[model samples]
Target: MPHLLPDTGPQRTLAASNFTYTVGSGLFLTAGVLYFTQAVHLPAAQVGLGLGIAGFFSLAVGIAVGRLADTRGARGVYATTLVIQALATACFIGADSFWPFVLAVCTATAAKAAGLAARSPLIRHYGGDRPQEFRGYLRAVTNVGISLGALLAGWIVQVGTLTAYQLLIIGNAIAFAASAAILVLLPPVEPEPAVDSPRWIALRDRPYLVLTVLDGVMAIQFKVLTVAIPLWIVEATTAPPWLISGTMLLNTVLVIALQVRAGRNVDSPVAGAGAYRRSGMAFLLSCALVSLSAGTPAWAAGTLLLTAVLIHTIGELWHSAAGFEVSFGLAPKHATGQYLGVFGLGAGLAEALGPALLISACITWGRPGWYVVGALFAVTGLAAPLAVRWAQRRQQAGKGHTASRQPPRRICQTSPP
Candidate 1:
């Protein structure tokens, strides 16, 4: 358990909002497909197409939405997106056909994307000093909420009724609406006056962009575990399918236990970069251990896979921890929302493409594929420190920070989480 929950009002509000929203997400994730197929009569192909379009649309518009947040305030725009989310999800009630379902998916997804792009910046702006530490608390709370919500959804799934499904969908909409209300309670973040940085500054900052890509590569651990590992257990390893559950359980527990601790002391860009490097090594070790499982006896393979999961989760925790620091630290304070929006692109792309990449490497290459994945992680991990340094230097150069000049950051600026 967390030693203590968030202490400040903003922290509490954000945490409650996240918990509420995720619970609804849990219910929807568990049962949405059934509603789409059986209740709405939408074909799987149409659903996939809609989701694909939504994903692209979200990525394309993310920066524009974030720009709007920075120009006005995240509070209003973020809350508006929440309302949009509520309306779109509730729109599911009327979506009994293909076109309606498609529109609903697109609208809901776009709102989610805009909300996601704004979220970190909102936390950074609203959470007082030590926002990163509070962020750690929020991360743990998010997991707890998701676990609870998913458990609740499991009960509804057992009911197997259209009413139960509708309840889940409606509850999601209500949750969004409620969260929007909570967000409305927050004080508005002041828009930076006369921030002259062009909208494309995020793209111009090549080093920061590179760090984002590397972070995306590290994030592939999630997809690899979810998609590749199960297949490996069934096809390549001698371990029984139950080992999959065991590994997953271990991952969740370790993350819940260690994520906050992993984030500790990584408040600075250099420290965060080092943590990213360590995460890469952990990923490498995890991959090596997982690869060793393939040819082992059932007992040994189980042990190896379990160990791999532990290391993988450790990498995941640290990666997330460092990600917050670097992403916030590297961003221009005036354009934080836009930069964060762009930063999210890498993860979005990875999530979209990870399965194909992992399957091709891990399955097609068989034993060697795991090794290749490890090497890829190692390469990316090693690059993190250099990229971070380059970003720091770039920022220094941008602000004309030399030996005799003012430091890069403002003296009055709040420290990053």
Candidate 2:
């Protein structure tokens, strides 16, 4: 916990703000679907469909808003997103039907995506010499905040009343508002100086785009525990129901403890690529282990499942750390917000599509699907180095071109002599 503390003022402020926001996010993540289905009486299918649609539309918002942050100012833009998120969240209480629910969820999702992009420049600016490492620290802080929020939310869920759910929603909105207020304490991060490049430089970077696609593919692993594991435990294995929460608790604790430490070792794009490779292999092995648990005795099944989760969490750490390094390191300093926003599209896509994919590939298809999904991650990890190399080469070439375009220095002649 001492290691999680920031050494400087801006870092401290950002950490505080992030912790506050994620606490609210944790509440929503834990109980938001239930609020729609149980409280509002919306069908479960409608909730999932609305969230999917919202997630899809929200992808573009990040890029647009992020560009605005780079051109205008990140601090104000980011704060505005939080205010918008607060409003949108409050509106959830009023969404009693499908369309209203969709509208409210979409607005909030878009704002959340935009806020992430807008915050990138500030992270780069105040992150000192090792912004990626600092990002890891914030992630650790985020897990702590979310865990706290989830615990509070567990109480709300246990109450099992519409009013209790509404209070949770309201509490989440207030947290968003409070988080924005906390950010006011930080010194403002100025806008990036204007450049003469194309308006959508990140979109135009083909190598970067390719890397984004790969990252998006790999991002499916995030849905494994959230969507697939619980279903698998119930349908395929003889493990107890309590293990669902237990596994999540274990994952959360490990992330909070080791994410920063794992990130420190992955300092460059090459190392990041290597980390990805290792992460993919870990995912593969974990998948195999999980598959073996399906037809086993109760004791063996629980053991295998727990072992798989431990391996998967290690892969998660590596994947997250590698992502931070590659995303930040490859981006141009002046266009950090735009690039990071573009990078976020991958995760956004994953959020929208990964659950369905995982369900089909892993659960529906049964145990063999696990190996197939694991191999996909392994292949994606193996491809990352090649994509990164392509991006690096292009960056170098672009720099060379810029240098060549500079006018030659005027040679002064001694004509007077």
Q: Model 1 off-target regions past 4 Å?
A: 1-4, 38-41, 401-417
TM-score of 2: 0.99
Candidate 2's residue-wise lDDT over 1-417, tens digit each?
788998999999999999999999999999999999989999999998999999999999999999999989899999999999999999999999999999999999999999999999999999999999999999999999999888889999999899999999999999999999999998987877777799999999998898888889889998999999999999999999889988898899999999999999899998999999999999999999989998889899999999999999999999999999999999998888899999999999999889999999889999999999999999999999999999999999999988999899999888785
Best by TM-score: 2
**Residue pairs clashing, model 1:** 132-417
Model 2: which ten-residue window has the lowest total lDDT?
Answer: 188-197
- Taken over the whole model, the C-alpha lDDT of each candidate is 0.81, 0.93
Top-lDDT structure, candidate number: 2
As for model 2, its CA RMSD to the true structure in angstroms is: 0.9
RMSD to the native, candidate 1? 6.2
Q: After superposition, how far is residue 319 of candidate 2 from its true place, in Å?
A: 0.4
Model 2 segments more than 4 A misplaced:
none
Task: Summing lDDT over every window of 10 consecutive residues in candidate 1, give the lowest-scoring window.
Answer: 401-410
